[model samples]
Target chain A: MQDALHAALLPQGLHDLLPPDAGHEAVIVERALASITAHGYERVKPPLVEYEAGLLAGVGAADRDRIFRLLDPVTQRTMAVRADLTPQIARIAAVRLAHAPRPLRLAYTGEVLRVVGDQLRPERQFRQVGCELIGSLEPTADAEIIALAAETALGIGITGLTVDLALPTLVPALLEAHGITGAARAELETALDRRDASVLAARGDEVGRMLADLVNLAGPVDSALKQFASLALPASAEPDRARLFAVVAQLRGRVPAVPLTIDPVERRGFEFQTGLSFTLFARGVRGELGRGGRYRVAASNEPAVGVTLFSDSLLRALPPPARTLRVFVPVGGDAAKLREQGWITVAALGPVDDARAEAKRLGCTHVWIDAAVSEIA
Target chain B: MTPPPNLARGDLIVLAVPKGRILDELRPLLRAVGIEPEAAFDDDESRQLRFKTNLPSLEIIRVRSFDVATFVAFGAAQLGVAGNDVLMEFDYGDLYAPLDLGIGACRLSVAEPSDLSQSDDPSRWSHVRVATKYPNITRKHFAARGVTAECVKLNGAIELAPSLGLCQRIVDLVSSGRTLKDNNMVEVERIADVTSRLIVNRTALKTRPEEIGGWVERFREATARNA
Candidate 1:
């Protein structure tokens, strides 16, 4: 039988990002930040751990289960390791930059640890690079964040990328407008999320018909909107429909090259989404590269839209970074000089007979001997 | 992914299915979908984790019920059969449940020993301790009713907990309620009805809509015919 240590091994869903891949993820994140930074987004650094109350406040309240809680040794109060940086960034925007200025453009890169990993993301720990455009409730701001996400993926050299835009509140507004409230409303919403027509039809004739029509309204952006335009939407929901159209129009005008699809009533993972939201994906990639949408700050009376790129999956979609020639130099050699020569330099810590073999074993392609470099044979 | 010696071709699409009873129920659906697995796939004695299907582009993997969502969500597998019970517990944003396969029907419920349940009033309880496979669902259910639930997460054999003093109640999946009855337990509150769904990676559907949509349609038709 295995020992207790073996039983204790790998609490599941935890993973280590190693070597070239780890560095590649970092580089991709940096380039993505640069792309967003070009759009006037300044960087922010939030603490890795915070008071559970602060972290769980407002829009972040739903993530209570995802957080890893620990008792603070000094204060004896509950603390939480951030499972998501978006909420913390939202908190930062509301408090730290509360008085900074109107329309705060903030970017952040940090590691988040989750209590458990999901189907598409099985890593408990991963890096996130994201940007938020605050203080804007405009359709242009929503469109800008979407364009920025697509462009950022492009900036990281990812091609054939697609951005799926979803309006989280559309259905709620529709259901409320149609007088489907409380339990019935939630049940109807679940039916929509699952695309289960049977459950939807069981609700009632009129409600079922409207929801089924709404489900059919999801497809390519142009076609879905055309369908939405034809429908006689309620007066209360007209504004939401109008804003969605405007956001789509802005995206079409700004970045026509990036293919955009519409999922009008998708509410999953958009718990904090207030208006237009989007998810980023690339051709041949398994998971979402990034996701962002419009949301209201929990305490601060400001509107915000942000996009967070998951480096774990983003790097997977991206082509492998061009390998830099790695050269090994014997101890006492000028390793720094080789670095300036545009090669990754490794230094031998101990003496070795076969310099070539040592260099290859160390993952270096070249070895230096007597101030001369030669490819490992 | 590299193909094993047993597989004839390259790794194409991986479909994750929960092992045991669900797999048994899914056999007819798989055959209806026009895919046939190698003979070893049905061999209970075989210890293989993955099996080759007649369609070279498609493969099958058997894992824990909870893991189907993870595999598909991560894109390690493009398609999966996952219960909404697992889906609700994990709440994977990356997964898209396009269809309810209408198989593996059950309900997630709150249960207690037959004796305790007779005297128990779930509505009057301010705080409750429970054993459950779904802590998130349990907590959310209790929280919705203005009750705080302290949950002890267990993998299986939850009915034994109530009698052994692990907890007076358990939140678990109830199919025919046979296990609960055998253990002298009774279900008090049902959280949600459960069923298997055709879960696909959200990105996979968007990237290769034709291929993924085709499979989704086949599964949908097969389910409809069976139903």
Candidate 2:
């Protein structure tokens, strides 16, 4: 019964990050945070839990059904374990740092718990480290965020990184301005999402051809833009197209080696994004390294661009982390010197009979013997 | 016994494809996409689970229809062909379905025995007990209508549920009315239209865009030919 009680059983979608992976995840978080901070991003720590309504107010409203809520005994108000940190960051930018300078750069790193794990990410809890530029709408700002994300991945030795840029509202804005609304707009959105040009053709011919022209404009940025260069667009959507083009152009100059793709119709995960949104992926990795784009601060109309890297996936994609060399030290010996020599000292509490055996038992790779550290045999 | 070869990270690209009925239509699509798997891949009698393809670094993994989504989502396999039904049921944020393969056409439906349908008004029901493979989708569907759906999660044999008193109604995939009639049940509502999709991990698509995107275009061409 005791053994059974001590069993490492855990709920589905939850896991214990044993040994090196746990330490590796922390290292990745630190390294990514360091990369973002180099660009003048100050770090902020949000509470792991917050008032449900406040946390779900703006960009986070999309994660409505996924938050875990509990009643607070003191205030009698419902409290929520945060499922996402972007909304919390937005709230901070809008309220707490309301008086801060323009383009408020804030970085954060922490764990989030979700009610159910998505298919790719089966962990109910995972770490998210991100930087949010809270007050700029320029295409240059978008380029900077993308470049910073690329730099973070590059810092960790991820090469062949590709950025998929999307103008979520561009197509919808164009269709609406061109008299596609209500059921028609929804149908067209579905058609574009599925790449089903037939549905567009069956419903309305003129709109169908226009959508075909737009949806076909997805590929390498240069070719895609050249296609968009000739096509007529709705008058109102001109700025959106222009901004996306400008962002792409600026991003090209900054990260010359990174490949870029443009897909104008993808809005599945970018519900709250106002203008441009981008997702980052690299060769051979299975999930997105990070993704972010444009959004407004909680109460302000100002634009913001940010990216959040998934620590778990990043660690998985990275090579095995370097283990700290640990040496077993005898009691009343030069433990401080071992520390100064760069060995992680595991000191014995008392005088030991066999330093080698003690080192082996304690899982230490080395032992202090006769004033010198030697490999345990 | 030796375990299957472990693919070193970035050394190879894996494609997860469904093993059974769907493969009948999928083989031609694979051909159109110019992917020719080894002879052992098509052998139902073969115990081997993974097979090498004509391309040096690409391979095929045969698995259950639902598992295709999981494997691709987790990055065990970077690409997969899965039905939207499985996609909706799992909802993996990391799995991005770029193209609808236009194969495996079907619909998910709610069904009940014919006798129960005459006197029972589903609209007036406050609560329902349903046996289904898709409990999440079942609950969400009924919840949207202000009805409580208590779903008993089951793996297959949904046709026998009503007779066995497992539940009054069952939600299952309907390829035709034959299964419903044979079970003394009738289709009452459609949950969603189903179709196979070419899904890729969002990260995989970005990191290896040239290779992944090339396959996407090939599959798109194949799908276009099929259409």
Candidate 3:
């Protein structure tokens, strides 16, 4: 009965990380952390549960619903499992890491919960490995994050991937400069989001018409950016547009041969992005491998940028890495000789062929033939 | 698993259903069109994200209302149902909203504390700070009138913003005005009347014209009959 209860009570949206899968995930996560840390990003671990208000204070409503909520019996206050790591990282940057330094680079790897609909075929309980480079308004920060994301994907064996880029500030700035009202702007932007040119045109404003026209513009980055170059941006916004172009130029310079496209009206995950936003997609996968963008400091009017790789998706798209093994064996046996000769060995109590097969299946390149194996063989 | 067979280029059809409110509203429409989802779909308490419909060739995935456009735009889901509000939010270029289901009736509007309505004149304001779920929409709405609106973007509970002093005004969806009245707010402006739309992935429609277009026409007919 106790065993049955334990089996039945396994937490929903949470599961035990089995040996081989767990080891594979751990290796990928460590590699991602090492890559980010090498680029001057410090690693930090945020709490698995945070005060409900702290998590929801500035997060969007849709995201608020996704968090796993509970009441802390001791305090009788609501608490929520961390559904996303970015916000907690933001809070840390705002409160704890405020005095760290200018352009603080931070990286983290953890599990995030989303009570996703069961109809979605992906795992709801999964790991997120990512980095956030805060306090930098430079395009270099954006380029570094994007490059890191691409490199991490390649490291995990995900090929034929492309990064779709969009600027959330571009269209909004244009609407503001054209004297569009807030409500009308929302309406027009919604139209643009839907790509409803007729709805945008119906607004009867030259700016809305121009934005509607721009929403249809899509192509390789160079052509799209060149087309956008012709727009008459205001003096204050010229720098932002220039910065966007500069970011594209830098990405081209650093990762010259990667496929990058500019989707000016792309609105997939712009809900949280304040500047350059991107989503990574592979050839066969239905969803994005990862997504991240620049988020503004909610408290102070400062620029911040970061990216997070959905490690679960990454693993799904790539083969598991090889595991290292050192097997112990009885002395003065075939396995002992194998171990002495630099092969991984364990005291073999079974057939040598079975042991070698098991080792190979577990991604161990070397296998030791123990005394028990010699006795059997 | 195995990426669900790569969606078969043109042989398969995936339908994207917006979870929650619209899912409930769409049940009857789906039944009318002969595409009932599995029983688990009706169990709102279920955690499943994808479900099989009555037809072997068709499947449904329940995602956030805003993601319907994304799913369809990326060809992840060949078809979807989304509110005009959502359609307005992400505006995916590859999606084409051809049919209006006429359900999920609501209006996107600007709301402020009821007391402020007595003295507030929208036309007289030179600048405003607004809390909204739709920043692009909110900023564009204000900018049209030459009013510089500082938008504080909130994902949900835009109504609570006014009471919490997060902002004096909020732009959100108003269905019955009960939420606003309960929060001591009044409608000050309207953004757009919203309804759920039948959106088809353009690439899907182009590739499987008959099969995909046939589903569209069937839904359109069902909508017409219901009307």
Candidate 4:
């Protein structure tokens, strides 16, 4: 009994996906991949594990701690399980497919394993479905990626979506312009990251007051943009604000039905991002459904942006998929014909006394009788 | 069929509050923010854990002071009122202490027996043992100054530890210092000045900015009125 109990236990933040959930996850991945592929994005499959040096090169530098590493016995070299797939796509774009094309579009779906988990999202092993557009510096690229993300989610039955746009570089650019460096810069950054307006208000400096005002500008797009347009920004940080406004305008032009909001100072989880970023959320979902932004490809330094959807969070946002109608076929029945008719046919291994009773026992909705499908209930 | 009022707008927003002396100071603040809980909430003898407010989209849950941070950090409750002492002790990255409520004034201090304090020098100490409900804060406070603190965790009656030889000192919240005087102890050090804060879940703030940010603004005005 003790051994059985121990066998049932898995390591923290890891679990098995069983039954209807596994099937539903597969459906969602396939639907999302097809939708992305329809927009001329080709699918690519990266391995689950790779050499630590090759895996953690370039963009993977910041993610070293989160990756699960082990030593390869044959080669005696270190290997690592990928904690994220976007870095791999970047590596491919820079190395393997370096000469493929300009503004290369690649889509991917695979499982990622992490070393640790936080209280909010405890799943260490989960699937990621995302697409990256590499080698583009256009604001339209940002707008396209965001619109595609929202459309892909809507195509998969997610509703009430809101995309919150962020400019991670805006505040840092402001601080650089002000020459506020050393400990003061670090303190102000922390205060901004925590959204602590009180601490910023206490500073009472011009920069401090500006940052406090930015903290309060995290709401709807029109009103926040109205307030943002009136701010007296330095010449250096003005481009970031202008670029954010342009992207917002483009996104509205592209997907006017989807809700858009602005958070000018949201920099967390976008440390690697270089420019405009956005996070997708449903009305009542607990966490972000998907997020992406502009980042420079590590090795090539080509500007890029991508969106990755957490399958676990996406599953929660979507309503449970409708159950497929399964029809039970007894021995000598035309199971193939039943399947061709768009019914999931469960074939009988041996003869049964009653086809309807057998269908009910096997959890089928219908049974094959006299060369025709009959409803079981 | 018509939907419930809370669901009609969105998910019901749960606000967690501490269940002790802080509740007395919080009553008027809650009213100023336009939240009035059911009459049974004031009885003190009710076993109820959750109570509805006058607002259709809001509700309140009474929990232990320390647990208030845990609830909001987990996003089980989208908003809460907790002392900074609990915030520092947990240091949950998911919480954003955006506003200081200016209530529940106190200080987290280290105290010991009067005789020990008379001849004791904190600078000369190499290692010290202390009892506290906030082991994280106590250890961190000592470690910042190149000292090692062996903390024995206790939930309540931390003042009894020093007198019973459990430890030479205890770290606990001191409001008036009367509890220490009654135990024949004297204050040795103050870690931080404590006050209740308006804590919002990081995710809630991002997902529902209008609703949650509106609440923060409302509370800001309420605190200002009280000041």
What's the TM-score of chain B for every model shown?
0.95, 0.95, 0.94, 0.96
Question: Chain A TM-score per candidate?
Answer: 0.92, 0.91, 0.80, 0.95
Candidate 3: C-alpha lDDT: 0.75
| Cα RMSD of predicted structure 4 | 2.6
Candidate order by TM-score, decreasing, is: 4, 2, 1, 3
Checking candidate 1 for backbone clashes, the offending pairs are A119-B69, A119-B70, A119-B73, A119-B74, A120-B73, A120-B74
Cα miss at A278, model 3 (Å)?
1.8
- Across A1-377, the per-residue lDDT of candidate 1 in tens digits comes to 95668654676777666787878877888788889899899988999999999888766776888999999999999999998788888888898788988788999999998888875567888888999888998888888888888888887888768888787877777777777787877777767766666677666677687677677566567777898888776676777788889988988888889877777777787876788788887866776788888888887858888889888888777778787678899987898988888777898888889888888898887889888888876
lDDT of 4 by residue, B81-180 (tens): 9998998898777788889899999999989999998889889877899999999999998998889999999999999998889999999999999999
TM-scores across all candidates? 0.74, 0.85, 0.59, 0.94
Error of 4 at A23 (Å): 0.4
Predicted complex 4: DockQ: 0.56
Residue range A78-149, candidate 4, lDDT tens digits: 999999898899889988999999889999999999999776778899899999999888888888899999
Q: How well is candidate 2 docked (DockQ)?
A: 0.41
Q: A218-257, model 2: which lDDT tens digit per residue?
A: 6678877899878787787788789988998888788888
Task: Give the range where candidate 3 chain A is weakest over 10 consecutive residues by summed lDDT.
Answer: A368-377
Q: For every model in order, what is the number of clashing pairs?
A: 6, 3, 41, 0
- Interface RMSD for all numbered candidates: 3.0, 3.2, 7.4, 2.1
Candidate 3, residue B97: how far the Cα is off, in Å: 5.9
DockQ scores of all models, one per candidate:
0.31, 0.41, 0.05, 0.56
